[model samples]
Target: MPSSVPKTLTDWWCDASTEYAFLGFSYEVTACQSRDQLHREFADIRQNFNSRYVRLYGFCDRKGFYDDIVDAAWANTLGVHALIWFGFDGDDLWKGRRDVLLGALHSNPRAKFVTRVLQFGSEPLYDNVLPHDQLTQQVIKAKANLSDLHIPVTVSELAYGFQERGGAQDLLDAIDSINIHMLPFFAQDASTSAQAWPLVQRDLQWFIDHGNGKKMYFDENGWPSVTSSSVQPNSPNAVADVPNEQGYFNLLDQHCTDLKNVVAGGVGWFAHIYSDNQEPGYGIYDSKGRLKITLAPRTSC
Candidate 1:
């Protein structure tokens, strides 16, 4: 018989929902054609897709990038699920960046208003950026610093991290919700879009069973429509082999159907991405900001 992994979930997670369905879009100006082009894409997200929220990976960009994000969100009436990364270059440089981010949030009314939830770190354990104990402490201190805002605070980690041993138990105990990255498409034995719901359901159930009854937020979720033949299967860059664009749409339709229940059951989920990228090809929209065939169903949701 196989032995059970130790439960890393703390007792503080309670039954509740944060009531926010965010769209995951990493903001990198260089990735886009131009700054104006990026702003137009955000506007398209709001007006076309009915996206109420977005999650940025981090705030360590060039001068005006923060403003660009806030302005775009505000103009479109979208909430911001802001993520912060501490892997800054040079000694003690992260503190300065952190201060700048907080300052913008404190001083800029639009920035503060659009900021719905503040995530302190992303995949820290998986990335090996910090020890679990220290990570927990950072989450505790960050929660204290942002207590006055009354928004939810969380540390985002991969689903497997929370399900297995040496996960973010202390951090989970400290925060307001469980933010998990549930991406079965990235699994080595990846499922076809048609076979995704069962896998996703099991994954979500694993988190919920161990979630200490806290709000389970699917922080990132999506399917890729493109695959490079040369890219090794089950590797970091693997994309499923759907027959055509219509097959991708069917997969998304079924995936969203599965997710509707999760959201209805007091959980939250963010679609994988807003725009397709050079690599991964997971975007619901092409690089030119045109809706991919898979995105038609999302517009009504």
Candidate 2:
């Protein structure tokens, strides 16, 4: 037997490389913010995955903002970094909510806040109702706005329930990093995992072509999803769930390959079934917050 073993790409990436595999747990601060709670949670999460960092999202929501909320949530926590954000500001909320969020993050040196689309122009839910030119202009302007705050915004959930894999070069060039929230299924798609493979390959090419020299993250893209029944087939409400087993594994395998080739800053999972009812039992961890073994760390080969 060889004296030393060659670590699998995943192992080396997570354990040895400075590029950490952050299997982050995301939640609104108000939901999981108490310092005692955050500390307890961090230790458990660390045990489950040996994760180097965590994303602490949603500090402010309809309930509104509070001073040092992020600080309060993360109080006394060590080894994990938080990505907090002020929640959605609908047409009715405070006028300068985004500005307040920015200032809060600035004061809390330990917190990193990522920005989302203040509004999406062509999203299907809006029937492409949001003005096209104005929204696109805002996206471009948003980049400069972030620079002014000295806050580098990592795009998250940008493709919200859509799948147009091309044009990533321009997209990546426009911001600090590109994040595509790609789900594994769409009721309209016939090939399931196979249908998404092309997009994955194209994204990999984007990373290979540019990411090695720049910051790029597929902030959300994965095979795990709600049950097949969740799909609302053959309607304007169509959706295809990422099924478990063979189909999902097929995509999971490809995703693993992409993780190997691409210079990913991190990958965030979509559910915390225990805390939020996004999709029950779809969590990387069980209802009590214990990690699934497949995702859990291994001590033996």
Candidate 3:
């Protein structure tokens, strides 16, 4: 299905399994109160998957900061690998909380540090700030902030997290130099939806043909929750669950297999574990985390 010819990297992807399982807490900020049991909970989540890779880094404060966020590392294996890119404000957040971000980055700048890096897949809340050269400059400067550092970036290639609407060419041109984890999260309606697979295929072909298809990833798709559709829309945010599970994963698996044939690296799962019945319901699992629900796409609900 994917037009990609077999290359060594693609070959590796075909054979390897980058399927990661996520383990998230209630998805909230934790002060880790004395005998608070957050650590105990974290341990349980980590051990639940046995595998070292983490697809879900909890549901709250997707960004890596704050005292509780720092404690998240304890949940991660010292050498375990994972990704964390819930719309990070690299330019602004890095400025004030460089230490926090750097600490997060240091864990796995290289593949071993963190299998991949993530960019902002957060909603296009700030469409105005992305179109200008300023966005590129900020990203560049942010990368510069870690010149000697081994931290590599994982980009939500489809995500346009700026305050303005714009084209991918500029963003690609901007990130071309940075040797981060070159992966796209399938967010851009263009990137994720099966209907847009044709365009994505074309884009991938262009990149591979032009030799500019740097490190790539299809990190998202299949979130059942509508944009901002949480468990309890009125309450604080919680990792949401997808409504039509099978239907959602059908597209997800198809995208994974198709891209696996094209990209140099194996595909990374969008998430592993997330909260449910809280705020947004984009999770692969149900609220109890016990049921593996699958919903097949239908012509009509």
Candidate 4:
């Protein structure tokens, strides 16, 4: 683990080694969730997974929720990759979300120490919630406003979304680093978990080829353990089962070193979620908080 705090995106990218690539999980903070629950989850992330960071998703509708999140993460010595989510809502909603995040950071001194990055929105362009230019402008404005915080500002999007927006250079140049969501399960060629790494590698290479020299991180990546009834698979071979879920982790464990070398500026990824409670069948832990599969520590590999 790194002993020092990284104040800039370049510092984080240059300092990370293959052995200790920033490992973490993506978490959702629901409204009205208690601080005790937040603390417990963050503690599990820090102590059990030995994670150094967490990518937080979802909105902060409840008052002082961001404060609670930052406090909980800091207490467990974990850095926060804060996300200002923009759903199907209008511009006003997302702007409000951004303001709430900024307010929390300004009010809490500890947030400075705990916040590693601020992602303006997750997949807003892909989801059609905001057009490319509008999202780009928002990111640029947020980046300017957060200049004093010294925290890198970015927008999380699918790899293809950036590609579709003609490389999104204007947006890319405005931000510090690239945060992408690359899930093999959703790909047209999706197959068994044993075969998912190749898809992951291919998508990762696509990003590296067009990444504009920016350090890239996988904001969401993992294989689901079971198929949710409400969801449909993109490929006939994209079956989800317990064995395949375990196989995916096994493959990930085997390729940790390879991932570090293949991607420029090293590689860091948050498993899609912390538990099945966040997204059905995507968690290493079940909804009941029980271990669903054997997750070998990244360092062990």
**TM-score, every prediction:** 0.77, 0.57, 0.54, 0.90
lDDT of 4 at 29: 70
Evaluate model 1: give its TM-score.
0.77
Models sorted by lDDT, best on top: 4, 1, 2, 3
Candidate 3 C-alpha error for residue 120, in Å: 4.5
Give the per-residue lDDT digits (tens) of candidate 4, residues 115-158. 88899767876777777887888888877887887777888888
Q: Which is the winner by lDDT between candidate 1 and candidate 3?
A: 1
**Candidate 3 residues 261-297, lDDT tens each?**
5444433433322344332455444567544554322
Identify the leading candidate in terms of lDDT: 4
> In what order do the candidates fall by TM-score, top score first?
4, 1, 2, 3
Expressed as tens digits, the lDDT of each residue in 1-301 for candidate 2 is 1133232212222222234233344443545344555556656555544544444344444322333334333332323223323234334232254455546554544333222212221121122322334333444665465554344443344342223434334434544544444443433342455566664555445454654445433333344444445433333332234344224434444455345444543332322221323333344544565543244422121
**Prediction 3 TM-score vs. true:** 0.54
Q: Say which prediction, candidate 1 or candidate 3, comes out ahead on TM-score.
A: 1
Which runs in model 1 stand beyond 4 Å of their true positions?
1-35, 86-94, 228-265, 297-301
* Residue range 174-205, candidate 1, lDDT tens digits: 77777777666667766466565565677777
Model 3 scores a C-alpha lDDT of 0.37
Evaluate all candidate structures by whole-model CA lDDT and list the values in order. 0.60, 0.39, 0.37, 0.77
